[model samples]
Target chain A: MSGRNATIEVGATSSALVALIRSEWGKAWSVRAPAACLAGAVLLAAGTAFTLANDQVRAMQTGEIPVGTLVPVAEILASSVMFAQMVVVLAALQLVTPEYASGQIATTFLSHPRRWVVVLTKAAVAGVLGGLTGLLTGPLCVAATELALGDAPRATVPAAEAAVMTAGVFACAAMVAVALGFLTRSGVAALSVAFVLLVLTLAAPAATGKVFPGVAGSALVSGTGDPYARWAALLVLLAWVVASVGAAVVSVERRDA
Target chain B: MRIDDRARRPAFRTFVGTGRQSGPVIVVPMLQFAEISKRYGPVTALDHVSFRVEEGTVTGLLGPNGAGKSTLMRLLVGLDRPTSGSATVAGHRYRDLRWPLRVIGTHLGGRPVHRRRSARAHLRSVALTHGLARARVDEVLELTGLADVAHRAAGGFSLGMGQRLGLAGALLGDPAALVLDEPVNGLDTDGVRWIRELLRLLADQGRTVLISSHLMSEVQLVADRVVVLGGGRLLADTTVAELAGRARDEVVLRTAEHGADDRLRALLPDAAIRPVDDQCDDGAWRVTGASEREVGLAARGADLTVLHLARETADLEAGYLTLVGDRGQQVDSVEAR
Candidate 1:
């Protein structure tokens, strides 16, 4: 009998982790919604930055504000990261929820029975794509704001720090979204929690609420003079990502697919 | 003890430590359920079920609704774990296999593709994990007759096309064993015949094929042996020939005269006699518990003129109903030859 026989060899040509990474990458880009969301994230960030700078410049021209008011171009660009971050959240949330909705999660489990490996790789992929979106958007928004504020008096030219902050925050936010996706396995449930954290309870002014993603993101993006607050905000965002992704991985290992 | 066995243990039992558990090596069956049981809080889905599917043959896991057929197949693929016993493929759990898709192809139903994702994209995603080549994906698409519509979104596909896509995914790795659940659920007649022939060819090429369905007629044409399940319990392990034979054993006879029924019963006193249809006084009658030979010989021994003599061939649905004791079950069609 040829129970193990085949017309062609079927062994793996790559390591398990590499195959998992490649698979997750394919899954992330295969759907039109995630790609659309990522594009929206970039456009929103750049467009918002352009509009803000253009409005500030126009207000100065109209004499509504004082002529010598200091303008922070980098801060204006980084501020738009908050709104586009929601699009990144939706895009990252997609990496986990579609499989569950289409019942393809079962196929994922079947293709690779190691649940932890699959979950972790998925989180990593979503994180990278989300980070890349922010990485490009951050610099693009900076450039767009610069274009809008042509010849305006500038307070600081810290585009590098602002871009890096945008990238780091967006990456961490995506990991949290992917984690939420796996934790809930339902779009409505995950999106509802996302809304509560990102929109509803945003900046509750409470110490605990400061740890919420939206609050931390708002505080971080708004910080201009104090470097310490920015560091604190970054730490809180990282903590959220670590905790959310950790719980999701454990749930996958313990629960049935 | 100075053992004289210099040969590498028996072929059936090989000692190895790279698979499932490390305590001892377990003998591998193509597909085996060793007293496996599953429960969902208060309900037992499978009760100490034990069965084995051999190589180069197609085995049908026959059962009605809630008979645990899907659960058993899921257990085999490591989709669901057994509460106590083990369900292994080739002496290893599905999760234990370094490359599972190469060993066992799985196609559980109720799974659909992302609506906006193309068919090629769906298969490619699965193949990417297995490190299978893009050529392999195209090969499967061609093999399943989906190459023409490979670029179409699966959401727009018809029922038959969807099933073909599922099978394409299963065959991506060219696994040795194929485990499918209700593979013919929404298939047309052509789809049904196509799958039947495909399964036969796969088994003929030395692959173990196990399919589950509630409609016995679905498997009547494809399966060689059927492992019947009822209420999550094993009811019968028999050949398709045995199940199909239920449609036989009674002979139909027609006499030249309308009132020859009494003479026929008198001639074959040991046989149970009845009319083919009671509404009409036609000369046709059904004789049970007797072969065509006995009826013919009895009629010849007497002066009875026989117009028509033939053995009865009924549908397997009646036999399945009798075996499962579920008269409310409905079969899609009666295809007995």
Candidate 2:
């Protein structure tokens, strides 16, 4: 025990969250489970791109490929979002629960004192990491979708607008999953809730549109069955993210650590 | 608020020869508990227990198993909230401190460091949290004598090593006060001695030290003040000397001679005499409230040659056993329900 002065300098806000993000990302990279999941998701997206690229080559030889195939190829990257979200949520759960089970929550609460800050820091890191993965994987899938659907009639919209919209869905889904993780704290519980909500709000709606032929059924999903729903779905996803993350913050603060 | 000079050490003369000490003298307690209470459902864990830890002393929270020792520690550092009470560490609730890790360091028993992370990582996280320079992490690692295995994962470390790592993490901030629960549980003899010295050194620097341990001998050797708890209630709170002074007095005698035991027994028939060995080569006798002089005189009259006769004052181990362990049989029943 050294006789040192006790100096408590608090309220370094942005820097604190940034520090936690870097630390969590570092740990995620080092852990084999998440790293493997990430690799699998990326490989799946790349494989789809390669297949679509082959289709583009064949269509070029026959001069029969259509521009509409580009949209589907871009949607391939968005397909990785669900698997990637599972990986991120599981990683966040591991980060949060170990503190409780191992009794490091005392250490953590002692450090931050404000429990909400600690919970929010974890949520923020998960969101940013998930969002970044979206930005990276989105463009590749778009190019692949474009190559597969070569010479197809372009919609009134530019190709870049569709690709960007597709990327936003991946980011939104990842954000929502991460927030759900903070809300649930248990890996299995968070995964279950995310699956139910994603299936009901996103997958089920699209499946419903396929069965019914009119506006009533189309309300469940955006028109054209594009990988990116219009901004409405993104807004609903953002609302879920906010609600889940806010609930986590409130519970962590009010309940005993 | 800074402590006033008068509060630092109350005028010793005023306390001298004073029969009645009144309430709320402006003294600054290193740690103050105000009507602290906690309950787990229908069971009361701690019932309105209050005590103070003064600087430069080892305040031992002595209790039998499940006497709320860990609960009190958890409350002190914000791991658990009191049902209806407050504790102030250095004039602030530990949780209210801006950087609590730097203000009040604690080592809760059974709360080990991350098994996968190296000891250095464990300490570095805390040090980083407090914004301490990286060197402080190494400083604590070296101070805890863990430098040799600093890079090794704590999972592979022995229980003693885990304990040391926990301590190293707690000490990363060089806190003003230290709270440890059963800190000596897994320590070797040398490790125990090292902690004894370390605690003494910290207390001497005017840092408040509250150590909770069931081992009376360990507490006796380390604590200047002892607070005994039984059934989650404060049983005895006093200095070590005061506790010893209040203990039951007994006289012990050992002798080996022809009919010495029977003669001594017949003279003082109330004495409890138990054979020390199978061969009766050594016989021991114990009598409460009897003086050694009386025994010697009785022996002289009885013509019994005495090999050894001594008056034994009850040590803290005996004192603790009498206060807490005498009622220890009820612990299982209490925890079972």
Candidate 3:
């Protein structure tokens, strides 16, 4: 028989890819990763409302409308997504790195001899889970914050857009974390590198905005360093995910697992 | 051994749209290594080593600790790429294979299984990966003697239990070929025997099985053909019978007589004679190398007494040691020169 007979059937490859996504999501669902991320989003929303609530009480006492008295649900949801991004990065670092450290990757790679398939499957699962979590948590946080603050801004289309934009950011960052974990194959090293990069990204723009006035200074917002420039951040983060994950997958196949 | 056509099970047809055999002959080589070389920075792991693994035989990749046994196994499964050459399993390189898990099974490190998941779940994941029926999970679990603990979490398993679980996972897809590296390392005596039986059965089923081990004794019992390597080079590639024949350098003999050792030494030049120092050796000499008839003739010629004259047979370990030792000496002398 030609050695080509050894090629795994297409049916098997598709099934394996599906199974990988299901199992990865299953693992995340079973653990504290998703729940913890939701909690962080809830906390951010509550914190944003508490600030609005205090501003309202002070306005009532003084018999005057407080400046920026009502916090927009859009702003609250955006902050919620930023907080979710932090939690997702932590989750990716903690969860994905175990497969490498515990030698599970060996079995995983052995099971799906196609290296790129495995890498892409893992990223897809992580990205999907991050999206789902944001979809669920974003609206819930907005609702809770509205309830907490008596005169809080109601849910708007912008809040939904902000939520999706937030989800995209978190998902991109989480995927990057997974990719880095695979490349470094060391949990602590990958997480440290991830955290350091995040810090640099957050810090460099703020420093640059401070040095330059007007357009540049307006780019630095408090919650995520800058909201207007987030598209650029998203692109940079996506590129990171692709390059790191591509390198990791290729190296895994070309070199030893 | 001839395969009995009558004993062949009916071709399995799971469903109308399920897996179907496309051809009569699966003519691809079981495994092919061509001019494979691996270098780790300043150190070379394997150098231009090449070999083939055919179906229905247990092929042993034998080498000492630094001879690249693990490296070669890694290269074969695409865990590590060859620096120059290529290794193909069945007919395709690992990365090119569409469904790898179902085609070729590999057990690289004997690391523990996923402790959080049950053995059954572990097998299920692998089976699912290959699009194999879920029933195959239980089949392999049972085959590896892991049925009793199939529902138990793999994390708390003993080392032997973990090894069995790993084996079960490897067999999940009913792979056509198996590449196991030190599969018996953590296995107990029973586990070792179980693997030996398992490999033999797989080979008997017309599947290629390549097992790598530095332990000659482990490979000796199972390997039909041995590929002995030293310093990352192929030293001896032959059948067990051939290796045994080549190792038949010493002939054993025993006699009871004072100064018989010296007399036998004098009779046959280059003959090694030593006094038998066992509990039964009461002034008896256990000499070797000379044939039985020659020893008798020597005894008569020396006017010595004969007690025991049985030829000592060389076992696999002895044969392996002899082969490796000879190669090692040649290497040492070459380095010296």
Candidate 4:
């Protein structure tokens, strides 16, 4: 070893939670996983918008489309939101699984011994990044749709509502994904379970006419369901987020690092 | 607090004499494990094991491959909870410390790092958790000789380099105590010697250093005290010299006069005297329980011309083997229960 001075001073002034949050943020972006997943989501959104816009433009050129057949910006934004939510879920699952797999969680515990603090800090970081991903991709999807349907009377949801709803959905999904990741501590297992949950929640509406809160709430955000259904869906999705995240926190605190 | 001048001096004198200080000493140990027992389902990994590592000393945790050395270290660092009892550093549980790295630094066995992160990024990330200055990362990188490759991905590093990165992470906080498990596993000869010197320097600075290794000779060379474990149970906890002295010591002697062995035997009836070899014509006797001085005096009293006389001192390896080997058999019988 070199004889260079290795003395380091520990700063104990800051709150442990804030330090943990900063560390978690660094950990989330330390690798290419988050960037790759977010980039993939944006690309998927752009491609979907380009394909739909091209189809509409071709129909107008051929003079075969009916007048006022507008593809609303909300519709395009909704599609991109769905895609981004998928990526967020995958990204959130990835955040904790690799640590557990490589046994880096032990080091994590060494840094911040309270398991709950680490879990909550990671969830907060992933949720914020997920929200940012939605914020960036929602407008990109709208711009793509606007470019495709040039000169058509644009129909769209209010900008503020679109931003809030889209980001809220992505953040909630990301939190749920983080919870599943902590519960399983295995990427494959967590991903498998998340996929199953998504399918079951998505199919619940079709099979039972929007009885499931997640489905009803998603439809409300897309502006397809009644106002009462929207309220009920919001409550249901919030409950799911709360339950999933709570269980994850408890599991992590009780289990060994 | 700034590092004092006394803390910077090399602890050569400390190493040469007894591992403790000469003046009035503080009684508090830097690290303590009290009745700590860990059980994983049907297997007991640690059984009521307890030991204190004093400040200004290097304690070696020695055990075989399947022993509970790793489990004990993990317990000390709060990586695992004991099924019963407690482990504390500086009179506080590891989990309760606001800044644990400052109090204790540890490098556990197996890979405990994200392979994809760069060496610098990894250290910085850990540093940020404790609110340490970013410059501390550079300091540790230089200390560990990884400054040139600080930005290199840890996944591509050799096993020895990976170990160095791990040590860098441990030393990042300038902890008062260090708990390292098998630190010399992938190191070369120079790397091994470097660790020994560094640990000695840290101990001399009044830092508590505990290293776990299965290599008896390595521990003998560096450790002031050796804590041996076998089958999840502590076998020996004492100074290196005392451990070696625990083993039987024999005095080997050769005489030019014929029947001198009989005369020596007659002189010390309580001593166990045996022939070194029946086939060899040289009359050499291995005598246990008699000092070399006693044997020489007896031979001189008998007017026997002594050709050679030497006392064979037991080494750490032999003493460790004797301790662990005996305990292994007992542990096996207990496991059958």
* Candidate achieving the largest TM-score: 1
lDDT of 4 by residue, B76-183 (tens): 888788999999776678887777887778998565778788888888899999888898899989988899998987878887888888888889878877899998
Question: lDDT rank, highest first?
Answer: 1, 4, 3, 2
State which candidate, 1 or 3, has the greater DockQ.
1
TM-score of chain A of each: 0.87, 0.66, 0.70, 0.82
lDDT of 1 by residue, B77-135 (tens): 88787887999876777787777887789888754688778999999999988889999
The list of candidate 4 runs beyond 4 A from truth reads A1-14, A52-73, A151-154, A205-217, A226-231, B1-28, B250-311, B326-337
- Pitting candidate 1 against candidate 2, the one with the higher DockQ is 1
Models 1 onward score TM values of: 0.85, 0.79, 0.81, 0.83
Question: For candidate 2, what is the lDDT?
Answer: 0.63
lDDT of 3 at A148: 59
In every candidate, how many clashes are there? Answer: 0, 12, 10, 0
Worst 10-residue lDDT window, candidate 1 chain B: B1-10
Query: Looking at candidate 1, what is the lDDT of residue B1?
Result: 12
Instruction: Quote the B-chain TM-score, candidate 3.
Output: 0.81
Candidate 4 or 2, higher DockQ:
4
List per-model TM-scores for chain B: 0.79, 0.82, 0.81, 0.77
lDDT of 3 by residue, B194-274 (tens): 888887777666666788876667687788898876777767777876776766645555556565666667777756666
Question: Candidate 1: where is the Cα deviation over 4 Å?
Answer: A1-14, A58-65, A225-228, B1-26, B214-218, B245-248, B253-286, B293-309, B313-319, B326-337
Error of 3 at B53 (Å): 1.2
lDDT per model vs. reference: 0.78, 0.63, 0.65, 0.76
How much is the lDDT of residue A190 in candidate 1? 86
